[model samples]
Target: MTHIRGEVLIRRPVEEVFDFVADQRNEPTYNPDMVFSERVSTGPIGVGSRFRAAVGSGRRPVEMRIEYTAFDRPHLIASTTTMAAAEFSGTLTFKSTPAGTVLRWSWQVRPKGALRLMGPVFGPIGSRREQRTWARLRDHLEAAAKPPLRPGPVPTRFRRAATSHPPAA
Candidate 1:
């Protein structure tokens, strides 16, 4: 099996980041390689949450069903696939830092049958692709989550500032 890992600093708090990650369906929104994703399990996300993610390959997208094997709040998540042609397992861990949250993603996979034959050709490529995927996820999450929004009306100060905008010539 070949393993690849990557990390990125996220702007959001650990808990918010953890929640987004815990929900498997959120991957497609960030990862450019993900063509689509859907949660196959019904219920709150936890150690048993399952999802099917289809990633866009060069020829066609491949769908893989994955289930969360472990989950720790604001910390760690480990999952493995239960789908054909998938001999892959992965973990994503988050840690608090002064700058922000450090999110790490790792995967180890062995290509079976026909895919194995191309290992020499695709192994390094896949490693790089996986790293890029994680980087995209980290960047998207951090950028999208900046300055949490509160559900309420605009304050008087904000209203006045908006109404007092410089008069157009």
Candidate 2:
């Protein structure tokens, strides 16, 4: 068993952070190791929502199924993930702060099959990988938060003269 814990401060609203992280499909945007992620269940994303994802692990891509066990909008989310070699269950807590939002994660990982023999070796590696992944999320959110530049009023000199009809043809 490996227990991994980490936190990251994101300069964004609690609701925004919570919603982005709640949707597993967004993982590939920030987590490079996540090759692909897709929602498998129907309806809105919340408790009981399921997802199918493939993540690059070692030499091959490991496929996993994730399911939400608990969901509290703008506050908390918990889920369990099962893969070929391991199982992970975790909770993400979101808290509002003057600076923005604080996201914390706590996960319990259990290795299965032949991988169980390497449990001690994976604890530290998993911790570091998770930390790096969330840090990228912070960068992604902060960068994405910037509003796109809107076109300014056209300069008077550059504006084409407006006419209701063609001038005298």
The Cα local distance difference test for each model comes to: 0.80, 0.94
Clashing pairs in 2: none
lDDT of 1 at 45: 84
Q: Which residue pairs collide, candidate 1? A: none
lDDT (Cα) of model 2: 0.94
Kindly list the per-residue Cα lDDT of model 1 for residues 1-169, writing each as its tens digit.
6776778787778888888878878888878778888988887788898888888876988878889998888799999975456477889999998877888888787778777776665557767776777677778876786778778998999999998999889
Best by lDDT: 2
Q: Show model 2 residue runs off by greater than 4 Å.
A: 147-169
